[model samples]
Target: MNAPARLRMSRTALLPVLILVFCVVPLALASAWTLVLLLIPVAVAAWVLRVGVDIGDDGITARSLAGSRTVSWTELAGIRIDERNALWLVTTAGTEVRLPVVRTRDLPRLAALSGGRVDVPAPPAQ
Candidate 1:
């Protein structure tokens, strides 16, 4: 692909979180110390908005709340699936980078974007 492919967490998940933030407003107003409670929701929203995976010409990038890391296609050893079903990018150096907002269902697209660097197994015959 000529342009980078971007995968992000669904914004719909933030709806309930935002409503919950509104619920915290009254309590925050009640006490000066309680105002600090607002940071919780703010951090959650920031996390949902900031975390994602980006596939470009150079390689794949994993972004988090505080920072991001990139693994060039040449350095990508493979992908790993944890017991919790999270996807992680394993580098040739043996370091693993968690890919946020990327699901197992997205493997085909990921493979395509990786230009065959990542492989997806063929389904079994019926």
Candidate 2:
């Protein structure tokens, strides 16, 4: 069996996090108050870096700023894409779990990871 596919924020999404951390370093060194402000960039980086989705044969695991949750294939009722292009996993209990950083382009990978549990929508006729 193939290993799980891990999806994370694209490098473009991470650029702002890196820039903020670098920009804050100077200010953080200058003042005590600024030092406290340093936490902002650190938190942003952590949030951006930690948020991801892991799809394996067993289930889908989503990690966010709050925490991580894994839903088995049997637990998922369906998957849908929102107007914003975010992927949402609808649970058997009717709960929606939003997958951060999951774009439309990632649907194929997600479908494959789920072993056909999730359906990948067909592309619109061009």
Candidate 3:
């Protein structure tokens, strides 16, 4: 019953971007050309907010700045964890969808969201 919508990037991730935007304000006032500099942080902030993994009872969706793809539980062949701890969903079609902000540590969360379509090994007993 835990409806956790863990976005790909935490909202807190935007703090630095916001700071950069604010810091550029004075420079923007000094020269109109400097205003163009704001685009970087703005784009980064937009990316952070827009891109991410969305796990629901029926499927997992990988979101990007350009688009999103959803893989239903039945289409999920397996899960892969890369060297960087990034999570990828391997489909029956042999395609892979990288789940942003979803590392190996988040597998349990995914299992819970999957409602038993996914399984994770239980943590070892200490």
The better candidate by TM-score, 1 or 2, is: 1
- Candidate 3 least-lDDT 10 residues: 1-10
lDDT of each: 0.90, 0.85, 0.84
Against the hidden reference, what TM-scores do the models get?
0.90, 0.83, 0.83
How far off is residue 64 in model 2, in Å?
0.1
Report the lDDT tens digits of candidate 3 across residue range 63-106: 99899899988899999878998888999999999998788888
Model 2 lDDT at residue 32: 80
Worst 10 residues of 2 by lDDT: 9-18
As for model 1, its CA RMSD to the true structure in angstroms is 1.9
Error of 2 at 74 (Å): 0.6
Highest TM-score scorer = 1
lDDT (Cα, 0-100) at 2 in candidate 1: 69
**Model 1 poorest 10 in a row by lDDT:** 1-10
Q: What would you estimate as the lDDT of candidate 3?
A: 0.84
- What is the clash count for each candidate, in the order shown? 0, 0, 0
Predicted model with the maximum lDDT: 1
Deviation of model 1 at 117, angstroms: 2.0
